[model samples]
Target: MKNYLRLLTHVLLISWCACNPCTRVESVDISAGVLLENGSVIYDGLEYPKSTWYEELADELVKRYGCPCIGRVCMWKCCGPGQTPFNGSCLDTGLAEVNPFNPPVYRGREPSNITAYGTFFYMHGHPCIDSYLVDTADVNEELFIQENGTLMEVAIGGTQWHLPTGYCVDMKYHNNSVAPRLVAAVCFPEENVSTDDSPLLYIAYAVGLLLSVPFLLATFLVYAMIPELRNLHGMCLMAYCAGLIVAFPFLAYLKLHVGRIGVAMTGCLVVAFIVYYAFQTSFFWLNVMCFDIWRTFSGYRGGSTNKRRDNKRFCLYAIYAWGVPAILTACTAGMQFSDNLPSHIVVPGFGSRRCWFVNWLSEFVYFFTPVLFLVVSNVIFFSVTAHRIRSIRQETAILKGAESSRSDKLKKDKQRYALYLKLFMVMGVNWTVELISFAVGGSNWYWIVVDISNIALGVVIFFIFVWKKKVRGLVQKRFRHMLGMPPVATDSRTGRWTTSSAPTEDTRISADETAIRLKDMH
Candidate 1:
């Protein structure tokens, strides 16, 4: 068991090292500007064809900043906050809010000094242009900036921003477009920049889900077909896999068509609803597994045999796991159709044409909160289960008699300990990392771990349960029967099948009896 744990740890460490680059504090100059020359727009360092008035306006703005990369416009700048450019907004804000915190987008920084310039435009009756700069150092700093033609000292609060290791700068620009609002600030890293190919992350997640489908299906079949495996534990495993089966396809479809324009609003809502319902069911079923294990262990410790308890317990579990998520998803869907809420508030990723829970409040209220409740309950249950397991182990050691060495008992205990650990890993621990990912706004190392662990859930379940020696034996026996093979010889004493060519009164017992007869004659 120690060796097994050590190997698992090594694999996790290697994966973390490989994914470390995603967590690095990347520094890159992300610029957004429109440059104009000779009545033509300069984009990508080349003249762009004139088109809409807004396009012309963007070109004019770029010319003022003397920047040629029109693609550098922040996404938030284009969407007018809480919307994407494709949803009837400017395209510039895409880069601005790429990260979870939506850090400030700044102009070119001085290569020789720690100073940089940021531009803010207030038009269409907007209040102010705000830029968030990431903190690079621990020094207390003051900034000299002109707000609405009035010079002021903008105080930088800390060395870090949304992330404890970073800092944020909130520069409020007075509503005035007549003069170019330029905020000159000093940044230690010279450029407060981040680059993320979230597409890669999305693709990795999609691949993991895809890979899991077959394994999950296999697990479902194994539990359904094998009568001995058809217990409360197997039922929970089947339900979990069944939920994943429903979820992965929709999720994969969204990833594939994430940014396609003109997706039907109803279709997006439906897909999102299905995805939420399925994934939530999967999560709750895990909670059920934890509860089931705890109950079984507690019962065993108390000398109770509750054979019928599972049948009654499962009915209640199914209602909670499946029915609760269905109700919540329906409520969310109904809320989306209401006239009171904005479209994005109801349907997350609405502008991007990807169905997701966009409003954080709505998501917290409907989805994440319920899942969190289940997770918290599971944690408490796991603690109690662990204590019960310990007690049971000690009791077993005492029953084994003082004549037995303590080391031997401990060795025997290892198998049960390993079983509990595997149960914890499969049922609940990964989601704890998911909760941490939520706390960190999905922009940290925890997100990476969550992504990897959740995606590999099917593979984990398959290896831990379906790929066991007994499971293999069952499959082999079934296969031999299907192929019309004769039953292998059996050992009557141990009730096990064995290979033997010789025939005896009971041909099946020849393999063992032949050896016994020879030993007796000797």
Candidate 2:
């Protein structure tokens, strides 16, 4: 009985110890201070607030050991007051203050004297306060941001500063009348400024470009398969369409992958070159078409029915159309890679920003200037041709009693002129709007609509060149010839397929016959 009672007492003690675990405590050194549950530190029988105690402790530690103490933990103080630790050293947080009336001066060190961190460095400057600095040699005079996030150059009193971190500060001043002040401050990432388009805008842009591909392909195929459509004008059209075919896809791909394309990406540079060359070639070919039409109307008999002569002419046109753009592209590539060029001459920035012309200045200087010249040349050709056509019409009306052949020829020439005029108007209007939109510098609704229409240019070309009863008949004839069937009879007057028993020519025509047929069957 006594033994059982002793065992019960030991069980009660174990239960009591388990229920009151905090009753036993381990001893610790509290000579300096004791922290209470209420977050108060006690020393010398006096309680102090945690914050007050920590402040006093920090001061004492700093005074004794030259190290900062916070919350009773000592830390190495790397930066002095009014400074912040950055890049392994303390950087002054103050900006460079300067009076515009005074001479240009840097408070700390000049940008040239500062250590460059890769392509960027820091200098004491107001507005950009502690931001990464851009080399003055890198950017143009003044910086502005477009609605699409592109950086623009504006001349603001010839005083410009730049930040590499995509920050813009408007430093507009009117001589000594205005006090030195920061007008605006905006921070955007440089990469995002180049790459980030609205999702909807990107989708619309890509879809519109892709939508024209099938139509462009069909137009090229139709022109290629039909021997009757292989005249000089037809060849020029084919070349123009081919350029669009190559360019549209590459342009879309560049836009899609712009974010991934770095300044040094060789693939992007090649793609950019190809796109630039193809577009320039297309414009040149269009110019060739305009010039050829003008020459024909101006009574230049060089475009004869001789196959050899036509072939030679085409070769010349090809050289002009293909070779010029190639040279321009080569020059562009040279400028892009050349480090020897003077600072005043802006180099092409292909692949540096977004796999295309870097800024408005470079784009205008290299690409748009040439395009604008070509456009002006085309306008001149069209104007001269229009006057010639009016004279020819008047002459044909006067000689209407002479022969039916002259009337037929006039009709054909008018049709050709009409087609060229339509094509020119379409392309000219699109590009004019594009240039205007670019100059305006925004993604406005009207510009977006215009851009979409521009992307659908292949569809417009197909309708203008191929969506005719004559073209359909030609397509049918080609298919029937392939299937071992007799060629469809076409009306000699209307150039349309007819069920009447009319004399039909064989589908297999000689090169001379094909060359002689200059009029598009319509």
Candidate 3:
């Protein structure tokens, strides 16, 4: 039922995206006078085009949305207090009024086309526009002259384009007007990103992190309380997942709110370090699980009988994986914190801002390292499956001409397959959650995605274990007896296997014989 509901939800979201087209407005940041439309915040103020044609706009949209990439669908982050969708309203948590954003449509450098998009630093929903498009224009250099700002004029046969700092204009597709692509990005300084107020991205991250707690607690309980899971390799991986959940909240909080909360300035990065390594550890644990399955199922459990997992090695590796990312991030942060990164590397919509990945470089590596691991691990999963099939064939051959009972093999195959199923389910959930939110046009999407994925994974063990037919049948029988129902014939209406009318001793002996024969034959 849960799977069916998720499938249905995904289909509905895809259909909705097909039906709704986004609206865009020419939003001007008076402080920068940069134009935002499509996804690019036009940064080359001197290069603003006079006319916007379909071809130019199409190209920009593709780049802005990072289209053709089939992974996660993230939002076009805005300079708002809460990582609000990019409709241009800015929300400031504690600072004075936020950046000014005014939507624009041009009446030819005329003052008539400029409309205030919004000024207050509070979220007011996404702006209604697919971004902006403009046609041929002119530049009144004197129109927005302020020290370094200048306007330029360019010609394309009969038309001229003008760009003014504070002026507004609109353009549409015209066969006669064509211009090269203009792109830029929206960004705050690295200092601001690590500031005490915690910008929108950090806040968005914080919310997602904070919600990870329950899953983390659930995970610890799975290991700490459940005796069956204590040494089981699969459960160990689940434990790692639990560990990842715990780290997400802590790392994100440090990255997002540590400074704001008046914690140690350096502690932010330290927590971030732990977070990075923790994720790597989790991914590595997942890889270990695949290997364990291949080894155990293939009956190649060759390790010495008394040998157990090395707690010391586990701790050391965890430190190294995390320490490496921290060191990498720290070096990068030093460069970034010192106004490093190449200037020629320009990202559209960023305008003139000159940093990338910001201060939470650790977080980026933390989140994204899994993608690489996921790909490689998935390949290993298939390889392991293929190898197991080959082993089964060989083992059956060794038994030469004897009819090999396949039930045991089939059961093992299922256990192997379940791991694959769980990983695929997790990925699918992330994609569906992300894709739907993108179509619906909201940045609150991340919060929902993170929370749902964590909770769902923790709950999966229950359904997969408790809902299987044989397992559930036993549970039902026990429950029926507990409820004072006399053991009688099988409940045919519910199709439950009925207990025999024989005595308990006879039943026990029969069960033991069946078990022995089944084991020999299997």
Name the top lDDT candidate: 2
lDDT of 2: 0.61
| Clash total of candidate 1 | 27
By descending TM-score, how would the candidates be arranged?
2, 1, 3
Give the CA lDDT, 0 to 100, for residue 258 in model 2.
Answer: 43
Q: Estimate each model's TM-score.
A: 0.54, 0.65, 0.40
TM-score of 2: 0.65
Q: After best superposition, candidate 3 residue 290: deviation in angstroms?
A: 2.7
Residues 190-238, candidate 3: write the lDDT tens digits: 3223232326655665665566556455545544543223434435445
State residue 181's C-alpha deviation in candidate 3, in Å: 35
Quote the lDDT for 47 in model 1.
Answer: 48
Global lDDT scores for all candidate models:
0.51, 0.61, 0.39
How would you encode candidate 1's per-residue C-alpha lDDT over 175-246 as one tens digit per residue? Answer: 233221222222222123344334666677788889888988998998787644565666777898899989
Best by TM-score: 2
Order of models, best lDDT first: 2, 1, 3
